[model samples]
Target: MIAVLFAILTAFSNGSASVLQRRAALEVPHTDAVGMSLIGHLLRQKVWLAGIGLVIVAAVCQAVALATGPISVVQPIFVIELPATLLLAGFMMRAPLPRPVWLGVAAVTLGLALGMASAAPGGGSSAVHGAAWVPALILTGLVETLLIAGGLATRGNVRAALLATAAACAYALTAALMKDAMARLDGGGGAGALFTSWQLYATAAAGVGALFLLQNALQAGTLVAVQPCLTLGDALISVLYGVTLFGEDLRTGWWVLPELLALGLIAAGCVELARSPLASGNATAPARARRVD
Candidate 1:
């Protein structure tokens, strides 16, 4: 339960950060899709800095959640970020969420709850085998590179989705590595031991890469184009990592139906929410138009 609370907080912090960062990214001009110059420009913006702060908070919460719970459990919880981001974006834009949007929100909430309850994921070893490290990192790097290349080759929403997918992969890898690092920390390995562990550094590197890709995604297109890809891709890939790398397992048989149904609800809700006017990040009315009598 404590881990669930931390994961919820992580979602809120990350969702808020995404909105702030996206807003800031759009305000700046970019010469290239994934250039360092764009990140440097974003770094100068106060709003982007604020977003980075929230990202740090989110990272802390995520770390605690991963340390205390299975990745299968914690990663699915991140799907909440989509609705949370939509809400924050709507509030920031001073746009009221419509009835259908509310319905989508409810669906996501209920589906996530049902899915988690039905999955009943079992705990697993946090520390992955030393031999698994090289292959896992290599595969993750290759996938990220491919996604980034594909994103750079495209334009508009397609590009954003690709970049967000790449970012999701990086984040998923980061969480897996962080879980390993946390496990090491708790295994009587003093704080200094983290410095010697490759997982710590790898997590940092992946996290930075993920942040860069995310900012690019935000700049490439609207949140509607980016959020769903990031939200879903990360969750699914993290579940795979939890199962393959950490040996976690979920409930079987009768529970499979609810979990599948829950995924459908989540998918439906994500699509609906992403198609809503207010979620477009450009549908906000003018300041005076928002003034109530």
Candidate 2:
């Protein structure tokens, strides 16, 4: 329950960060995509810095959540990030959300609840066993590489989706690594052990890489294209990592039906919410127009 609360807080913080970062990314030149120049340009933007600050806060929340509960339980709750993002965007734009948007939010909320209840993810270890990280890291690297290559080979929404997927995978990996590092502390290891863990450094590296990919994704296309992939991919991938690497238990057999249904609802809701004007940065246009008028 404590983990759930922190996870929800992390989702909201991340959602808010996404909106601010997306806005800042849109102002950067497309030519700077996937390069140091992009970071250089973003550093000049106060909005992006504010977003980064929120991201740091989210990270702290996420670390706490992972330390307290199973990664499977902690990570899947982030599916709400999409709905949260749209809601925050609507608030920021001072736009009244339409019926479809509200319905989308309901679907996502209901689906997440149903899914978590049905799956009941638990029985995960706080630390991963030896030699497990080797195979997992290799497979994750290959998958992320393919996604990045495909993203680079595409344009527009295709590029955005692929890049966002890669970012999602990186973020999931970061969570897993963070959980392992936090375990050192939970297992009676002091700050020296925690700081010295390779997982700690890897987590930092993965997080920075994910942030870069996310920036490029935001620049590549509309939030309509990026948000769904980012939110859904992160949730799914994190669950996989939790189950496989962390030995988390999820219900099987008859429970698969509701779990499948839950995923469908979540996916459908994400698509619908992503299509909203608020999510796509269009809601502010009317506000600006009214101001002009």
Candidate 3:
């Protein structure tokens, strides 16, 4: 249960942090993606640094949860962070949210709560021991390679969101992968035991690479558009892997379809809220000035 709880907290924290960062990014316009990222970095240096620290905390929590719970349990907890984020943004950043936005936020939270509570999910990896460095290297390489190729083929918003979605996917996968990596290290595996890794390098590297793309996406589009897309995209990708591949073993009962329906409602509502200027960076209301760190 500790694992499940922590995963939930991590998801919430990550979403909240992303929302804050997106808002801060909005402070400047007329800048290119690289330029905007740089400026945004400068504008919220202290805040982002705190956020980085929070991410460290989140990483720790995720590692713990993955060790104890099924990937299905863990991943859902992480995905729910989107709603937690909206609440956090409301309190810390004073982000102006309309009634519709609040309703959308409620939908996400409700859907996530139901989804998480509805089933028995079981899962296990091939090994309890391996080298961290190996997985970190491999996953990161794969994601970066994919994006670089995609970037060459695409432009405009597609280019940006694709990177962001990739980054979000990487993040979701990273948590599970890092948890696996940590499991190995804890069980007395030395750094030299590189070959015994399950898929550490692949997952870790993928997660980091995805983060790089997310920054690019944030640079290209408004937080309103990018955040929800990333949130939903991560949920879809990670959960699919968890259920179909990880053998999360979640039992779909009476609530499964309803839960899925709720989840969709929440996602749609979030998108609708994001479309509003008041919920967006360009029109960040006066109340939204609080730092989400």
Candidate 4:
């Protein structure tokens, strides 16, 4: 439970941090995409640094959480972060967010939490095999690479959405692998165990690379579309990994019916809000329009 709590905290914190990071990224002016990213190299800035600091803190919290919880439990919290990010962003800088943004966040959070609750939090008959993760890790990497390539091949808002989705999927995969890594260590496995652990480290690298592309996507698109779509990626991936790789189960009883309904509502809220005018694909970022800041 403590692990779950920390993972939730980490997700929320990171969500808030990304808003600031994206805003900072938006501040750079450019004649082309490269020029915008290069603006920082040509000068100095602190906000993006602060965003990095938050990511580091989030990572530490996540690491500790994984050490304590099951992967199925840990991954859902990553979904919670999308809603948390909107909430955090308001408190940090973008106060007075339109109702739609809040609505989207709420939907995502509810859907994820309830979906996991519908599953067995702990008990299941099938066990995850240690060796199977090797291929899982490789496959995840290849998928992200394909997404990145595919996103690059697309145009306008669609490309941004694809990339952002890649980022969220990356984080989700990392969260799953991280929980697995922690599980291995708890079983009395040591550093030498991890050194030979190609899967764990490989997933970690893929996650990191995915995040890099996500940051760039944030700079180019509306948060409304990006945040929720990206968030959806986490929920779906967690569900996939949870049942197949982690042995998480589903509950079937009178209460389960309503729980499932509620989750659908949550997803509805998230998707509806994601495409709102406040975060529509063509909407101009407040900070991006200005040449000097």
* Best candidate (score: TM-score): 2
Instruction: State which candidate, 2 or 3, has the greater TM-score.
Output: 2
TM-scores of all candidate predictions against the true structure = 0.79, 0.84, 0.70, 0.72
Report every candidate's CA lDDT.
0.79, 0.83, 0.60, 0.62
lDDT of 4 by residue, 234-263 (tens): 656766676678776656687678566756
Query: Model 1 reaches what TM-score against the true structure?
Result: 0.79
| Better lDDT candidate (1, 4) | 1
Output the TM-score of candidate 3: 0.70
Give the RMSD in angstroms, all C-alphas superposed, for model 1.
Answer: 6.2
lDDT of 2 at 199: 97
Candidate 1 vs candidate 2: which has greater lDDT?
A: 2
Clashing pairs in 2: none
What candidate 3 gets wrong by more than 4 Å, as runs, is 15-48, 123-161, 186-203, 220-225, 252-256, 276-279, 283-293
Tens digits of per-residue lDDT, candidate 2, 1-293, equal 89999999988888888778777877888899678999999999999899889888988898999999988888888888767877777776566889998998999899999899999899879999989999999999999999999999999999999998998898889889999999999777788889989999999899889888888998998766776788778878988999999999999999999998998888788778877776665655111000000
Of 2 and 4, which scores higher on TM-score?
2
